[model samples]
Target: MKIAIFDISNYHYTYLYSQCKIFENDRVDFYVSKFLKKSMEKEGVLNNSNFNWIVLNDFDNKYKYYKKVIKTLNNKKYDYVFFNTLQENWLLNFYFFITVNKNIKINLTLHNINIFIKCSRKLKIKRLLRTIIRRIAFYRANSYNVYGENLKIYLEKYLMKKNINKPITGIPFSIYENIKCLNDMNNKIKIIIPGTFDLKRRNYYDIYNLLKNIKNFKFELILLGRVKKDFEEEILLEKFKKFKEVILFEEYVSEEVFDEYMRKADILLAPIIKQIEMDGVLEEYGITKETGVSFAAIRYSLPVILPKEIKVMKEIEKIALVYENFEDLIRIVTKLFDDKALIQKYTEKAKKISYTYTPLKQREKLFNELKLGR
Candidate 1:
């Protein structure tokens, strides 16, 4: 079958394209919308003929963008067109479906349904428009895919409200199947948090204080990803610099550097306090209803620390340590550091769970659902 995967977000196209290429026998054509051209250009060569992938960075107008793209691809006779919908842009996804020629099968990969719901609820005008768009999109989708089971449940509830019959499946994100585990275990514990350094999502100040208080353990905290040019970065840098063990890489690190930190760290901290639904000062911590960083930690065999109230986190409790406050976090980390047996147990459980979402397995399931041969 001739397949064309359209990655609207563009950030995930690299990983998505890699998965689609596993079926060498099937002719797969990949296209990324020009949303991240600057990022892609910085990374170097964009096209790989071996993978049958092309980066198209130009579109004439918003109204005719999908139509023209579909018309051009129709001439090549694509059997399936996979549209990767963004978490925050349901209306745009639905608009594309409505305007485009709908001869081909349409499948949507839902990254974050919670974000969509929360955003719609906050904005009255957007809520009404999005509701209509969602109803139409849900009705048209042949198959719906989600990253987590929680999202699958939400999608089903939404579909029921719209009186639409559709199949929503839990198709988790793909990770490298044969990832090499780090063998060199040392006495000093290294903690790394690799993600967007938004002050709202990550309580970096609280984390800094927690680490500072626990001086007995030889622990090093590494913060990766780019920090926005704001007062928050300046304040964080000033405060964290006093601690000799804390290392800050305040720029966008390469994939290799990010993976290096992941492998080196004894534990990955995803201490996202549930602050989105909270009141006043607490809301400053940017913990939203939908956060994807936990998936990354899970994929890397990192024991994630989260708040107890997060319902979606309950599934991975075996590999997670739930804590409500800084005291809870310090206690858990101290206990784990002192007990080698407990550390091994959690590490093994995390690795075992991570193996379940390997790229090869995910690809097989995705292809089978799409009715494409192995």
Candidate 2:
């Protein structure tokens, strides 16, 4: 099948494209626009033969550009068109309108729904039109794919409310097989907090304070990904600077280097603030024994720390350490550091549970559901 995959979010270069590599035999002709081109170049994965990366210089006016691009691309007669990100709601809606007018088959992959809902809130008339457009799009599209079970359920609920009948399949994100298992915990307790060091979302300052309060601990905190210089100007930096155990790698690291860090870490901390619209559900629902950071933790038999309220994460609560707040985080980390047996037990359990999320398995299920293999 000649498939055209469009990734609007561009954050998928580090995660999504790596798994897309496995679809090489599927004759997939992937196309990524928006932030993906820059991300692929930054990650040094832009030259892959299976995909074409396009950069959007005028992203502020993406709707006009998207319509033009889709019109041109659809002329090529693709068997399938996949939208890898949620912000493509407008593009997907437009695609359905145009494709329905022209009679073409299309597929959509929803990464998150909150982004579209937020956009809807801003543009009242556009929101109403888009809701009607979305219902039409759902009805016309050949297949609908969601990243997580929770998201799939949420989307289904929304669609049911709209009285739109369509099939929505939940497909977990796939992790590359190249990632090696580093089970050695002999090194110092290295913990990595990946993702943007945005104080609003990650609340890294709270973690810094938690670590600072627990001085003389042997654990090391590695802050990976982009950290704004303005963070130092903020008052939180004064407190963050006092934590000698915290090591900041402010610049974006290559996937190889990032994976190395994940392997080295004894624990992966996702101290995400509870946002009603955040993609944490994707992490909780899609994460299995074989995905990305969570999978790496499981592969290394390392324990991960997550918040207690995330409904899907509750399944792995026994293996995961849940923190109610920064104080709870400090308390848990301190206990884990002091107790070797508790750490060992959770580590083993995490690894055993993660096996269900492997790329091969996820892809197999996805292809089966899509009937693409047939």
Candidate 3:
């Protein structure tokens, strides 16, 4: 079972880093890219020396990078290669697959199926070409997995239309299982916002307004994760300086401090925007984009509040709260503040559910499925 999770050097801290640790065993290796960015080069970037991490060199184009990746790992003779590259390279993956290491099996995780769908629906020659490339790469893959139900559904239809019958499983992004679930019994309801404050992706404004309006409940709000460059708009939304109940860790937080926040917080607030019209990124209508933190809330035995109508909430709603608007979110929080027993119920449920997807269980399942072949 010589397995490898590849190309996580760009920005793996969100979900890729945890996947590396989850699938890691003596037989597995993390093929990290040497694409040094501020996210991984900074102080909070995870120290990946614990596992067999092989640094991969990057190239100007996808084909060159694929060639180099295959050449670099030729000596290892890996049995399975998990291609975790972003969907921006969807058009090039077919060529990469056909050209490099054809003998080896590949398990691809599509991160942006929605974006490709959006692009294909448009009536333009460029999009038509992109749609063709998208289908070819998608169907030609050895095996495929997805991060959200929405994307999984889209893949099914996309593959069906192309007359390719491939099994596409919705794989929950992995979280480190070692961290103890901290069931904090705080007097004030502490709600923490996790992940980057990307203008198009998250709703920091709603969180800010929620804090300002909710004077009846004794609570604190903490903003965690690396703030994007244009995050000043959110800062302007609510003068963070005046809010005594808010704490901001506006950078990539270390794993230690993040666990501490999880321990102290009573509930996690995930105000994910439904869609983002951007290139090279998926328009995520779900928490599956933030699967790491959402599951972290579960792993830490804390219930979470997510945006309503999110595709992932279909499963998450059983263990956490969902709200449609600010008022709805406020009412939900109010209920949690008044009902400690309910919080305990959700916490227990979260722990129970999170346990179902433990690292050993998940990796073994993935290995077995990939072994079955498409």
Candidate whose lDDT is highest: 3
Q: Return the TM-score for each candidate structure.
A: 0.80, 0.75, 0.80
How accurate locally is residue 352 in candidate 3, as Cα lDDT from 0 to 100?
A: 69
Residues 1-374 of candidate 2 have per-residue lDDT tens digits of 66666665656664455446445545555555656666556655556665554545644556665666677565777666665554535656555355533445566665545433323434467556665565555556676776555566676777788786766654445443434556355656777787666765566766866776767767778876666667443566566656777777556676677767776667778776555333222222332212234444543456888766544342245576778877788888888878767777886676666665555666676677667752
Give the per-residue lDDT of model 3 (tens digit) for 7-92: 64466554564465454453666666665223344523345444465564555555566566667666568776777764345545
> Residue 362 of model 3: what lDDT?
67
Candidate 1 TM-score over all chains jointly: 0.80
**Candidate with better lDDT, 1 vs 2:** 1
lDDT of 1 by residue, 157-225 (tens): 877887777666545554544556573446667777777777766677778778777888777878777
Candidate 2 least-lDDT 10 residues: 281-290
| Cα-based RMSD of candidate 2 | 5.1
What pairs collide in candidate 1? 200-286
- Candidate 2 wrong stretches, greater than 4 Å: 34-79, 86-103, 117-140, 174-178, 181-184, 229-233, 276-301, 314-318
